[model samples]
Target: SDYSQEPPRHPALLVNSKEPFNAEPHRSALVTSYVTPVEFFYKRNHGPVPIVDDIDKFSVSITGLIENPKELCMKDILRLPKYAVTATLQCAGNRRTAMSKTRKVKGVGWDIAAIGNAIWGGAKLADVLELIGIPKFSYISPCGGKHVEFVSIDKCKEENGGPYKASIPLSQATNPEADILLAYEMNGETLNRDHGYPLRVIVPGVIGARSVKWLDSINIIAKECQGLFTQKDYKMFPPSVNWDNIDWSTRRPQMDFPIQSAICSLDDVNNLKPGKITIKGYAVSGGGRGIERVEVSIDGGKTWVEASKYQKAGVPYISDDESCDKWAWVLFEAEADVPESTEIVAKAVDIAGNVQPENVEVIWNLRGILNTSWHRVHVQIGR
Candidate 1:
């Protein structure tokens, strides 16, 4: 692995791993603005970032179980109708660090920052599929293709040095309402090497792992992708299940993230002058669900207060509304008077009434994915 070829990263990022680089911004950085800047976006990579210097020559091969297999180059894709989508991409292991404290778990040790919201610009994947002879909203092809596999140019040890790949159901891939993008730009600029540069698949509202970057090809398969990251990794397991008894096929890959919220204005432990305090952070749900309410608790979890939520500044957030970006996150804030030392906690509820669990132990898994437990931070007020 040639680490030298990797692109430069933001100096403020807290790097978790150097090779196959993975880093995240501080929790405070996440809530500074509604749309996360590209520089502050978390980087989750499985291998060295592949360099594609020749955009004109680069192309994505669309093949497998298709009537008309076509290799669409940059120009060919750019001709399709363009759409901009503001979506949040969260790693399946976003809160692995918190999960690890309950019990030992595998994978990267990440805090609450393994997530980011960005405005992605690109051609609609449904439009691209239409060019390859698949009509919009088709669930299966005439040749028995049920899944759309996205293969990347980057290689990882997890796949035994094979190119990383993942897949989505054919129904989702062909549904224009899904807002799936073969994204070419991030945050209004051409994607930097850290992100998918020439091309990538943006499977909005799903776990970030399925959005394969630096895309090399698209495959119409009879079944879901059998890649290591798909079949062996990213699946949740019971707390009682260990490597000995773990069955990979028993559980399906995690898709939509659960309801989640966190306190970014304060640290895990903080000392502050006793006075009025403004608590702010991000709240988001998966599968196009909107955050209904964010509750803040200053006296541990015994009592709670509903925090105000919004997506754009000065505009109240309403789920599934035309104005609200259904795939994006909502930022919440609440003011409190802290006269004595107390533990502060925050939990989110989506529009569907799904609330984050109260305890991490109960939802503990071997892989440490989807730890949507209440986020807690302790405060020591005054001397």
Candidate 2:
């Protein structure tokens, strides 16, 4: 089935699926720059892309819990105060391939490159909502609205072949720290169709799935969104639970991702010199948490050396002022002397003290959604 509507993509992308145009670049290409180039920003779509022939006519409805439930066209969006923020967007299943090594898990078998960082520009969702009038940011409004739901124009089987929708707690939606945006631009230009042109919501510090593409409508309601995506798909399960025994309701929807780091320098079967070897990778934590440091171990997890890390755009492999909020990821590198056959393991610790688990068995689940365990790579000692 021809599920995609966008034009041709870069040939270098390691395509995961063509129906929805899901693809990613190699880990080396992904970390080439602090703000990943938009062309290689790792497209992740669940359904057929909508054909928006008229960019100006693309309008989104803002209904529910508002004084004016009206339709907003592109003009309406650009008229608002625009702001740009540099952040990383990562799929919940970014490292599913690693999890599958331990046990079979269902979902896209993504490699380390399923994530990308970029500078996004748009009108703040809060400002857009205020135009229609929020009145108050109470825990629960008098009208019984406690959540803000985002609906996408794309239809998928996950919602029984209907529209894709999800929500965030109203408190979080209205929080200034949340930095939610109705984004229209990536880098310095308009967004590409594959990356949600015209308008799309950017739920910073959350999984990429929650940032629904192809603008449609939004609603403020009581209770969480009941869309299949919010209710069934992104929830995490314990390692003991299989599909047959899964109690979907018992688990909470994943909001912020866990501490994750990976070794992107050397690949399996790749030849490396016998002397001092250098390893490079990226590390990121969810919910605006900063990475304390990344540790690399040449002889497995027995001993570790802190990797040099820098979190800034415009300069690659160079450390910036360490005071910036951790909205983006930290690109890091570490060196160790190599001997015979060996494996290198890397893990990151977040500001909140969360460290990557040693392996997937401790966090494995049927879906294999969040596979943020220690990342290991094997290399051959060569001449």
Candidate 3:
């Protein structure tokens, strides 16, 4: 069956772009469930999904600035020791919608759904790099002798653009804590075509775009991959800056995500019996930082209470491990006696002591990059 043609099953709260690639979901959805099912997980793609007919013939080429070049087939990659990790994949522009509210920005109008968490299974990237003879001492190259580039097997001809490619700094590529992988499976099954079938790079704690899908090649270089996806886009700018008065050269690409949390319950309108109401949601942080605490407020931040940890309805308990570094979001809940008429407000805080901004207007950027703010909902109390 062609999955691409099928409509999304769950309700989508946001839609960033259309056609070959799309991004969706709002911050409110994050707390709806602890384990975001693959069917409901947000989908983010750069180009048309590439079809790989034969797994046997599929091979990833490793070249550039290395003492040895090697081509490893699917069989060869699977033969190497396998590893599993539970991690989250978030788009650099996951909150772009919030940013767009301030000013116009290029690219998709992604909402909070650009991020999701799952168990990723694959070969360790460090092991793969060692097999290809990438010396341990080689410092990752960036713009000039500084970055490592990852190329995808998929290709497309845009109106005036050449091909699409994504890159990352050498530090992110080589960091042991980054948990980079040549992932072949997600949530215990073969990767779906939309999520990059056969093989894709999974860089935990980094932006999803850099985790190039349909991964085909890796070039260890002294300069950043000069692809449009990396250098020309995904950069963050101040709210004061607009398209007409911006300096593209001075901007930096978004790498690590910031601490964020959101309320997943109490939609714009809900009918409550007027006895008790429960608030639920999830909170996460980038750069391998775990969520320390999540606080909920029912009265618009006027007063706060620590949400009961891991007490949400649908979240599964995950044990801590070296490979699974507390990466999954923390599901939280708060139950309170409610009056006949009132509005419900909720927010979250991460391990770094970074609370979700009080108002979207405060952190609203022209591009809607980081929209971490208090989530509010109104409910009518029933007689």
On TM-score, the candidate that comes out on top is 1
Candidate 2's C-alpha runs over 4 A off are 1-4, 135-145, 313-325
lDDT of 1 at 52: 96
TM-score winner, 2 or 3: 2
Candidate with more favorable, higher TM-score: 1 or 3? 1
lDDT against the true structure, each candidate? 0.92, 0.81, 0.70
- Leading candidate by lDDT: 1
Mark the regions of model 3 whose C-alpha exceeds 4 Å error after superposition: 1-17, 23-33, 102-106, 136-145, 156-162, 311-324, 340-343
Residue 122 in model 1: shift from native, Å? 0.3
**What's the candidate order when arranged by decreasing lDDT?**
1, 2, 3
lDDT of 1 by residue, 1-383 (tens): 77888998999999999898999999999999999999999999999999899888999999999988999999999999989999999999998999999898999999999999999999999999999888998966633359999999998989888999999889889999999999999989998899889898998889999999999999998888999988999998889999899999988878788888888898899999999898999999999998889999999988999999899999988886899999999999999988999999999999999999999998999999999999999999886
For 75-193, candidate 2 gives per-residue lDDT tens digits of: 88889888898888999999998899889999887999888888889988878777777743435553335788999887776777788788888777766557888888999888888
Backbone clash count for every predicted candidate, in the order shown: 0, 0, 13
- RMSD (Cα, Å) of candidate 1? 1.7
Off by over 4 Å in 1: 140-145
Error of 1 at 369 (Å): 0.2
lDDT of 1: 0.92
TM-score-best of 1 and 2: 1
Sequence-dependent TM-score of model 1: 0.98
